[model samples]
Target: MWTVAGEIMGLWSRDIPEPNEVTFTTMIGALAQTDQFKEALELFRLMLRKRVPVDSVSLSSILGVCAKGERDIGLCHGLSCNAQGKQIHTMSIKLGFDRDLHLSNSLLDMYAKIGDMDSAEMVFVNLNQHSNVSWNIMIAGYGNRCNSEKAAEYLHRMQCDGYEPDDVTYINMLTACVKSGDVRIGRLIFDCMPSPNLASWNAILSVYNQIADHREAIELFRKMQFQCQHPDRTTLAIILSSCAELRLLEVGKEVHAAAQKFGFYDDVYVASSLINMYSKCGKMELCEHVFSKLPELDIVCWNSMLTGFSINALEQDALSLFKQMRSLGFFPSEFSFATIVSSCAKISSLFQGQLFHAQIIKDGFLDDIFVGSSLIEMYCKCGHVHGARCFFDLMPGKNTVTWNEMIHGYAQNGDGRSALCLYSDMISYGEKPDDITFVAVLTACSHSSLVDEGLEIFNAMLPKFGVVPKLDHYTSIIDCLSRAGRFHEVEVFLDTMPCKDDAVVWEVVLSSCRIHANVTLAKRAAEELYRLDPQNSASYVLLANTYSSLGRWDDARVVRDMMSDKKVLKYPGYSRSVCKNDTQMILENKQ
Candidate 1:
């Protein structure tokens, strides 16, 4: 037959003179099979030129072309294939294949591949009859949009329509459940699989892994081992991730040995995970050993190294690694830029932040919300309120996080009025306030002695926004009242607060008592603080300070001697000053 012969001739090219429709269609299908999609599209074009009759088979082949084209064509190019696809659609209508179920399914898949769910859904609704493939494609479209409810509805409708769910159906269904965090449903599906493959097992474990059920996932891994199934890179990655979180050093070593035995250690993802595991375990030497033994470093490995340094408080090392990454011709991603900016923020290095900000603007990453948030926080940390506000205004997309950062920036700068104004503006802009928003505004009120405003916001929390006040909210209210010397009000408020075990609230009250020289209230607060956090040196230090403030030298000496006996240490605070001669001095003496 010409069909079987065309399959063989697919290996080589020859011009066939006066080929029939079957020969042309067979050749085109073979071209697509060999991944010569461009050639396939070209052949389709030639068929159109010769006015060859089109049918469901050729229409499906070209429709497959559109889907593959969207993927293979990067973001900037690939319009020509789409243009060709539009012409194909017109041809299909003329050829009476538009109503063909298989052809329509191909059209649906093509539209979904390119993120046009509207068009995909349109085709689905217009179908005269539904196949398992149709149901699966519809579910996949909703799953891609994270519409788990709609996906679930379709699964029910598919069963009602007497179409048995297949492997692809369950896989897409599980993906939807995973996105929705319906672990219960995920388990049910996994249990129903007649013969679950490795991918199925991995997907199930991934569900447990994402929700941070470390013990459950580890137990599942052990079960997999008992079944004598080999652990792939994903399995090892998941297990090592749990090992890092739980700090199971010995277990990590065993997993590392397993990875080595399976020869999966050389894979970049596994290696990056290994680096993260070792880094988080505080095994810097082991981490470096792993890095050094790597065949070569990739971008992910470099970012992991930088993240390791940043998390371990080695800001300088993180910055150094970032520079090295760039010098090695690795362009920084959003995560990389945010991490580096955080290092600058941690060190309060305005100069370095400005340097990176310049690069961000030049590279057009200034519009990146993550990087912009980091920049705003960094400017606030470095005492550049104007810079923080400028970035806040320039950010085109201002979410609740951006608003929170800007409000907190004002609060930290001691501009309570501006902070309140921002909060009002946030309300006007319809950005809902979260817990952090309340914390920032209340902190602003506390520092500025806006007791009335603080109390009003505190009262409005539950009624207006349905946000119940937490320990921070209560603590802020206490600070606000105590700072204004409303000692009686502080007592009533503390007694009425819903949360009683708040050591932080007591600590704030103790500090305020020290400021007002209220030895009685200070003693009560210190007692509660010591009871809550026995080892907190702040309680002892403030208690001793309270005694000294009352001119009770003997009592102060007694407190100091008690601290010495208990081995409590003071956490010193620092201040930096520049003298008249422009010489800088840093002091770390007392609070």
Candidate 2:
């Protein structure tokens, strides 16, 4: 009642007069109710500064806010919520609520949300009372911290203490499995559950989705139907995400039909997932149709629709929507700007990219690290590699992707020296190079013919940074040796690769053979490439071009006829000024 009266009084009261203990707590409640969590916290601090008596009621509401804001809270925005949680704990003790179990539980939860399992355990230890909720919080805390082993340890302890596992307990344990990406352990826990509920199944399915085990996610959804557990909106969302990523259009359409039948399409999250799925599958028409059907749209929905257009190479459509989005009185999110900037990069539109760059600055998202990275990429894609480097240097921070983009830009612009130097600096600055970084630097080495440096970097990747080379690495080295006309080195390197039949590397070798007019090697590479990736037109074109260079018209005609038989349309030609890396492959035999 006091809290209620304080809320009404607060709206009308001028000068915001200070209140007694009851009214101070009331004002805290009123602030919290209005979602003015920061203000509520400020009032709590004022209560302490003015020496007002504090109690559990005010502590409970404020603690809940701090707990939920753990990820979101930052020192720059205010006192770190985690730091504030500790401060509030000190206040709780001063006010004689230290022994209050309910307040202590809230404290334990706050620590857990911050992934401070040790502090949570300390609270759990000193508490004179324990409940299943307390145990569950601890287990869930470890899971949130990705310390699945510790979560399992607590599960064993909880069961030994005669607190038999309930549905919630099992859910937390499975959540640990999900965090660890251990399908086996999650399956074991699910099988032992006395009765698994919908959330429990969703949790496991979500794990599969997170790990990109899309096939398992699809199978599990089918099993859910067989077991007669009605899949809810969340279930549909997760399954649709899997379908979108895997490009399983048929499965996604079936789920879409089911969503309409069950009315889950009414849910914004479900509808958004469907929009994303359709765009990923290259069905922009469906993406637009589903988006237009929404009763209302939020910023997230707008971002999704714009992202769909950008990723599908519909830059013009994305720009149209961007104009429409702002006209609807919705501001673009940082992600929205980043996605549109990426679209500009894709289409290599320098003038348009500059426009978005100005807009990002006007919108005050220039400081967003992702938007900054996109600006670098946009400049690089527009053929201004030096400008890209300038943006990269100006940014306050650089993630691996940003570093890779700069390195790639230098390599593409034929500035191998700068690319290599930037890579060295990336290590000096302690930003770990990932597989993409290796690909970029290796390509840099190939472009500059820095063979020894490239080899050393490639060899050091696994030992120094624990990055394993994928097929792209193999193809890059082949490109390096092939361009340098080192046929012997190429053959030796090919022998060292795990598989000689790697279609991409063979294609690279074939391309090199075509450039060097090494008919014998070209024939060998073409035969192997055709055996491995027969549908690829580049391999046949390379072989036919090599034949034509040697004045073997019949052989060249046979290859062209083969393409015609396979119904493979030959690509149009490129100007000789194109980048040397991909230019050879996309060339035509214009005899």
Candidate 3:
């Protein structure tokens, strides 16, 4: 029928036969499949003019067109509210399709796609009997809006209402749990499944993987295979993530073998995850092998390979691959930029980072907070904090991440005073500072030896900003006091901290004592640091150096003898400088 209609339309040329409602609807469906929505809309209008019967399928086809083609979220919402979906909705009601489960479900899904959750709920609430699919749609909609608790609530409510969820529904629920990182609830949901499929197993495994429960993820995967449910692409993705975090080379090989056995090695998502896993585990050769075997690549594939190279400090290779991706017309997402720019920062490739920054501006993503923050980080790391500041100031809107980046930039550049000032500015602008922001501000004071200022900011955070100091924040304050030669104050502060004395806090004071050549405090710090990081030879070496710097020759000799007795040799110091376009190792000391 479609072929005959197409032939007729082709033969008529400019004066094509006026298509009837059924013919127009079928043609619209075809156009929608090809994503030629504008022509479909015109055909629908002609059908209305000719008074042809507009059925539910025809109405839903137009709504699908609006949902797919509309880019503006607000405009899509307005369309769902007014003209776009209005006529079709009224037609559905008049034709009794509103009472039809399939038509109503499609309308709910369409509104959800357009971010018209209110309309979707209205449609959902009016349903005489809600299917598990409808319940899942509502849950997924809430998840899309970052309302994970509401999503979980809906899932619970669905169960309470006696709608047994299918695999799709469980996937949505598990996804919400993953997003919320509510492992306890996720486990409960997992336990309640009548007969869990491989996908559900994968979701459970993923929840564990996300929360750094690698041992649990591995155990779950073993249990999954024992149950004779073969791992699919999703299963492999989660398994590889666990291996990546744990760097369990031996177990990762087993997962790799499983991938080959299942023949999911060619799957792009699985392959990408595998590449990331191998790269993070420091198996670059295997990462390359996996990359070479994949016949087709997506943006994620490219990103994974680039990220792998960057993680291994293979900056040049990463850049070359990035260029290859661009030549293939694969536009880099913000994540790609973030990775490449961070690699640029690591290698001090300011020129390349700047070039990427220019490209970001040309692509009109300069205002995007993620991209802007990446640029800021790269600039600060390359000793161009002023450039970073300029970019940050020009950002149209500042998110918490962006603000954190700017504050960190100030801290890294030794402008801790400026960082503290920016913190004040951030609060004045009504933007609440997160824990990361407080860390940056406090670290700035520590670096610049602003003990009093650091104390004030640390105290103000709990009351004024309502940001309770974390371990890192407390450590930074202790370091600030130590840097100013206020060792007793640091010791007193440590005694009063709510959290346990982290090795990092002890290390901070120890290093500060070494810098100031405070022998008495250095001994106290050394004792505490050694108790915390017993295997760290740096602590021993640093304490010995403090004694040497203070001309306490006997004490330094005794410290060195103790190190020798323990078979803990000091790591040789080395320095580097870029001279005439060449990196030269200028110094080295051997035992």
Q: Which candidate achieves the best lDDT against the true structure?
A: 2
Question: In model 3, what is the error at residue 262, expressed in angstroms?
Answer: 2.7
Which clashing pairs does model 3 show? none
Q: What TM-score does structure 1 among the candidates reach? A: 0.76
Model 1, 264-307: lDDT tens digits are 76777888888888889888678777777888788888888887
lDDT (0-100) at residue 444 of candidate 2? Answer: 93
Cα displacement (angstroms), candidate 2, residue 532, comes to 0.9
* Number of the top TM-score candidate: 2
The lDDT for every candidate, in the order shown, is: 0.82, 0.84, 0.81
Candidate 3 C-alpha lDDT tens digits along 303-349: 99989999898887898899999998999988888888888877776
Q: What TM-score, over all chains together, does every model reach?
A: 0.76, 0.81, 0.79
lDDT of 1: 0.82
> How much is 94 displaced in model 2, in angstroms?
9.7
- After superposition, the stretches of candidate 1 with alpha carbons farther than 4 Å from their true spots are 1-51, 61-169, 461-468, 487-498, 518-524, 551-591
